[model samples]
Target chain A: MAQELTTQAARDMAAANGDANRRAMAFTPAVDIFENDKATVILADMPGVAADDVDVTLERQVLTLRGKVTPDAPQGYRQLSAEYQVGDYIRVFTLSDDIDQAKIKAAFKNGVLRLELPRSPKAQPRKISVKSA
Target chain B: MLQTVFSPRNNGDLFADMRRMQSAMNQLFEGTRTAGQSATFPPVNFWASQDSIVMTTELPGLTEQDIELTVKDTMLQLRGTYPEPENGDDITWHRHERVDGTFLRTVELPFRVNPDHIDARFENGVLTVDMQRPEGDKPKRIAIKSA
Candidate 1:
């Protein structure tokens, strides 16, 4: 059997609740991870989230992406029907040792987040020269 | 013997059964949820006012040029295409969850609206459409006077 490359492995992070605070629902954003010879790129759909509201953190080989979305209902309007739920987007990924932590770069535009994780020099493929004896 | 009893084949069968059951459950509960929650891409919310009807939807990874909106009678139509940025041959995909394709969403308004009075705006990937109700269709308040 061949290993499946596209894995939907992201799990929901439990919300913390207290008496004084109400926790809103958090949704898992759809993400795509693509790899080239130089880097691994991740693109996530986070609609309604502003660029400044997104937070990406890497700790102990765990990479977490979180974005806060503020509801944009017009004033003096009552919601009669809703098809999609309003909430924040959260996802986490476990990074392998082959990824260079220091060289990772991320950018957000038009509600899409792009993250590039460059491969370490040692992990890149190199051709070996052979001499005839 | 115990290892063989819990072999890879058995595990695979168990996972397959679980996946099948999950999808079956999803289909069972599909339409019971809110309209947007159960629908396809570009889920929308509808709001009503005395003089206008409003709708909003999220369309990430799209610009104004990628979307088209149309209003006909009491029907509102939305059409858009989300293009994939990377070429298939150039990169190896580890996880592909975001759908990229053309999508069409048609919603029927409760009341007829004036086509000329409709307003739409796309900001930060969210599209809001406001349709003004015809003057006669709006709710009217009648006054009672003493004879």
Candidate 2:
């Protein structure tokens, strides 16, 4: 039941994510996240997204992912086979306060976006070795 | 077995010839050999930098948990699973474009990337892999001796 609920929530979020300016947009972005020693890395799959067209905004605790992809042809060309589309991508994620907002960073290359979210300074690794002074 | 590739048998060696034809057909009806857009394989681009090799691929419609990345030898591989659009069926697609399938794209690396240090991240619809070079391979500044 919970899984179903979450899926439904995502659907709702996607619907609420897009805007009118975009020629097209993706409601969802395929992504993968992992934790490292210093930061959490987030990878999103956005084909056809141009570098200048992407917008990454962090407001309060919500991270919004947005971008636009340029269409290949202006018009009037017969497309032989097209497995990709042109559109903008919009999505939002509620983040925890454990993230260092000021230190968050992002990069877009080859249709992929990488967001680096550093852990809070307090979360840094420290050794609590027993030193009987 | 290696020489058999050159042997004369209709197209080549009987088995080798058949395999070549099959691969060609797959590329035509489907695509060369790309991970299906429906499958886990996201499209990405990888290039070399002065100190590191970077890779990026597309993975729209997936959350963070839907991907898995692994490195072996000098090759990097990504795998993941994602649901097709809710309208996967409803669409009377005049032209279909998303590549979907159980897709795995293996990238061969020119230099070895420290597996322990490999960093994979996702945002928007792209996956970025930060491949750090082995310590010894990194450039170092030499001490300047007095001339």
Highest-DockQ candidate: 1
Every candidate's chain B TM-score: 0.70, 0.59
TM-score per candidate, chains pooled: 0.75, 0.42
DockQ of 1: 0.56
User: What lDDT score is found at residue A59 in candidate 1?
Assistant: 87
TM-score of chain B of 2: 0.59
Worst 10 residues of 2 chain A by lDDT: A1-10
lDDT of 2 by residue, B97-118 (tens): 3444456677677688888888
Q: Which parts of model 1 have CA positions greater than 4 angstroms off?
A: A1-22, A124-133, B1-39
Residue-by-residue lDDT tens digits, candidate 2, A1-133: 0001123354312443435654454656655655665666666666657778888987777787876666533233233323344455676677766788888889886566778888787755566899898
In the order shown, the candidates' Cα RMSDs to the true structure are 12.5, 20.0
